[model samples]
Target: MTAPDDLLRGVEATLFAATEPLRADEISRHLGGADVRPALAALTEHYAGRGIHLVERGGRWHFQTAPDLAHLLRREKEDVRRLSRAATEALAIIAYHEPVSRAEIEAIRGVQTAKGTLDVLMEAGWVRIAGRREVPGRPTIYSTTPAFLTHFGLSSRGDLPGIGELRAAGLLDPVDEAYAVLTGSGEDAADDGDEDGAGAD
Candidate 1:
């Protein structure tokens, strides 16, 4: 007979090692079981004292460092990608006014954004292709994902930092400041490339 504790531990280990969140069904399938919630609960309780904690959000499971321990991990705030001025402008426009098309983004920024810039954001699990706009060309529309909120520590896009926040943080340079706002650092950076979540990019 397979010990339930063993099963729980296995699930916990898998979850910890995962680069992105997983669904309970994904865990159960990996462990050859139909129901792993009990095992997951047991594991959550077992690791309740550890530095990390397992959590479920948006139907996905992830292990995050305990809240109290997070400060220890804080580095300079930064963006996942070191976006160019044009890219940053484009992203900001899309984020604030989402389900927008490339044309709209270009119109707002007054410059044509490179496809690669959007690709980079998509790869970062922040921006995602929502659907085609109902226009003559049916251009694809882009929007921020829930993961964007989670990564930015926001409950909704309405919580996105405003100009005041940027001014207060003294992150004025559009490029570096954008990264700083997103990643807590101010350097030419790149995406970690963990886009496994649903419609991640």
Candidate 2:
């Protein structure tokens, strides 16, 4: 029960020629009203363990070099642009509570979010302008983009890590950890021996 050879070839060619990933309907339209599911599945199976993998990320199908072979294709070292603490916090807030306005982000962060912080996230393609909120001022709102899910290897927002996972990973701030301990909500954090006079400051 394999797909037709011509259909598979068309799908493969379309994906390879695409500058970006395409949705199933887009692929179907490109192939002139053909149901491309079988072709895609067959291609996925055929490309398994090959130099390039036919993968679906964020509901868009595209071919990418196999993970193990990626380094071999790199001609030079990539410039690593590390995110600042402000940008990281803003990204997390956008991911967790999307379609949020700038005011909302600031309110949750308890600090004024600098425009540059969000500009970096947008430049990275993880955050996007969702639209203006429906209010008197109509403050601009933001949301995580499909690129965010793809980069994070998440199928959807529901796949984001939970608070318990963050706590277990020691990502929760000291303030939250202390409150958890005080309320008997979590285990005590370990002393890394650098805290002898830490509170003295």
Candidate 3:
């Protein structure tokens, strides 16, 4: 039988070489189908007080800098581009009510969503054209990508903060009020545009 030490070593090695976080099943498959849950639990405890700790995000596990000590490794300068308010609202709407058409987005926002706003999200690799809605004109629907989950540290869409949580965080506003309409109906609406004009492939 492979000892716990050996299992721990395998898990550590696999994670260190991985480009992305891995779930326990993925780690197990890489380790020849060994049950790795015990090994993972032990490793998580072992790294509890370390500068680098084993952390889980979005149902995947990886190593991350200790939150308290992270500032020690920060660079003096970093270029940060802030998202426009329209882009932010659009992203939130897509995330919460995905596979949504531009018309639906406009309806929810109560304003015309600029093509450039969606363009920026696509360029960032966070959103994608899911498919055309099964409605008149078949308007293209937009959805959040896996990159969105990874970038936002969400395990899944369900992991997004609830309305109460958003309100607690002071993030709820008049725009968010429109979200109730999304939950109430399943209508697929059309928008004026072609695939090229949509800006996302």
Best by TM-score: 2
TM-score of 2: 0.75
The list of candidate 3 runs beyond 4 A from truth reads 78-81, 155-159, 167-201
> Which ranges in model 1 have alpha carbons more than 4 Å from their true place?
1-3, 41-49, 74-80, 84-89, 92-98, 106-116, 145-150, 153-201
Selected candidate, larger lDDT, 1 vs 3: 3
* Clash number for candidate 3: 1
Shift of residue 90 alpha carbon in model 2, Å: 1.1
Minimal lDDT window, size 10, model 1: 192-201
lDDT for predicted candidate 1 compared with the true structure: 0.70
Of models 1 and 2, which has the larger TM-score?
A: 2
The runs of at least 3 residues in candidate 2 whose Cα sits more than 4 Å from the true structure, single-residue gaps closed, are 1-3, 73-80, 167-201
| lDDT per residue as tens, model 1, 149-201 | 66665556666667787778776644345545664554434344322223322
Give the alpha carbon lDDT tens digit for every residue of 1-201 in model 3.
Answer: 288788899999999899988988999999999998888888889999998888776578888788799689877773253455566668778988898988888887777787787888888888999999998999989998766776665668877767787677566653453332222221221122311233332
Candidate 2, RMSD to the unseen true structure: 8.6
Score each candidate by Cα lDDT.
Answer: 0.70, 0.74, 0.74
TM of each candidate vs. truth: 0.58, 0.75, 0.71
TM-score of 1: 0.58
